[model samples]
Target chain A: GAGVSQSPSNKVTEKGKDVELRCDPISGHTALYWYRQRLGQGLEFLIYFQGNSAPDKSGLPSDRFSAERTGESVSTLTIQRTQQEDSAVYLCASSPRGGTGANSPLHFGNGTRLTVT
Target chain B: AQSVAQPEDQVNVAEGNPLTVKCTYSVSGNPYLFWYVQYPNRGLQFLLKYITGDNLVKGSYGFEAEFNKSQTSFHLKKPSALVSDSALYFCAVTSGNTPLVFGKGTRLSVIA
Candidate 1:
């Protein structure tokens, strides 16, 4: 089966510009998660969506970050007025189920490298 | 608050020697622990997980992790290291329905 896929492997944007990163989760995956990986820092959770219900936006760092998942499938993470601090690799992962107890491994996609100049 | 700690910034070992990367966690109740590996220019790859009923869990690429409830530790280990095993390793923990909290990754360098 195809793993999770994200588009625009690399994107360079000017500061204050908006950029949208897309993620296509595996077929039938009920859960999707977004994370940011900055150099010398661990992966930071961004947002999560499960089964089309209200997404968990708690991990979003700021109001400039927002994400939308449609029908438990494709998801888009947008950053408005991108900043140089936002430069990092945005990773998307999917799992078959929710809850922290589930052993279903998270399948990750090759992340989008967003560089804000 | 739930958290994870990877004390070692880097671990170097000779190929064919045993290797271990230490991780400790703090969380209320039980902990859902996982180990992931990342090669250059790649996304994290799940290596193994320890949920319950087992202290020693084996995972992909001949990697294994031992869960120690008393010490609040889940240390990744391998019997024999290979040069290809060199990469960044992460330890993560989640309690209940919360999202995974990752530790500062440990870079493993296996010298052949």
Candidate 2:
């Protein structure tokens, strides 16, 4: 894809139900990231993946939230049991490279608006 | 640790007036600063960044940001405001191998 792609632009689920959000990063991008944005709030980092190394799960809000990325391709964010507080827009972004000094600009997807009822 | 602060929740300006959005950051080492804009029902679009070199960095859509090391500020500026420029603006910062940290977004409304 020319840009980052996310599946199911919108999802509404009942409390306690599990939900999975998928992201397809841009081809050749080695770094992928997931973020959550609450209504009228700033983005909150959820997880990050760089190449084949272990993902950085430091930002995951709770154990119920986990993500997996296969190599440098598709990634999935799964919320074990949804709650009303879990309602937010889940965004995916990709960058060509990853590191501190790297000047890799992130390209974002349209994001999935998750609503937990 | 890295963090970003966008003090103002909203900014209003006339179409022809100049516009500015304030941002401040905290990082251990040299900071990588970025500005992104979000439109209604659309994804975030990159505006500009400051890594090194000149303090004044130019970016897309005739937008520019000044990296002030002393004040820990990277303020976004535009010569003239346009109605089309009205959107949600975000300031982000990162250092070393840490993940990007973003501040609460600021809403810019340019009245035409």
On a 0 to 1 DockQ scale, where is model 1? Answer: 0.69
| Pairs clashing within candidate 2 | A100-B96
TM-score of chain B of each: 0.98, 0.98
Report per-candidate DockQ: 0.69, 0.69
List runs of model 1 lying over 4 Å from the truth: A99-101
lDDT tens digits by residue: candidate 1, B1-112: 8899999999999999999999999998889999999998788899999999879999999999999999999999999999999999999998858778889899999999
Q: Which parts of model 2 are misplaced by more than 4 Å? A: A99-102
Whole-model lDDT per candidate: 0.92, 0.92
Span of ten consecutive residues with least summed lDDT in model 1 chain B: B95-104
The TM-score of predicted model 2 comes to 0.98
What does candidate 2's lDDT look like per residue over A1-43, in tens digits? 4789999999999999999999999999889999999998999
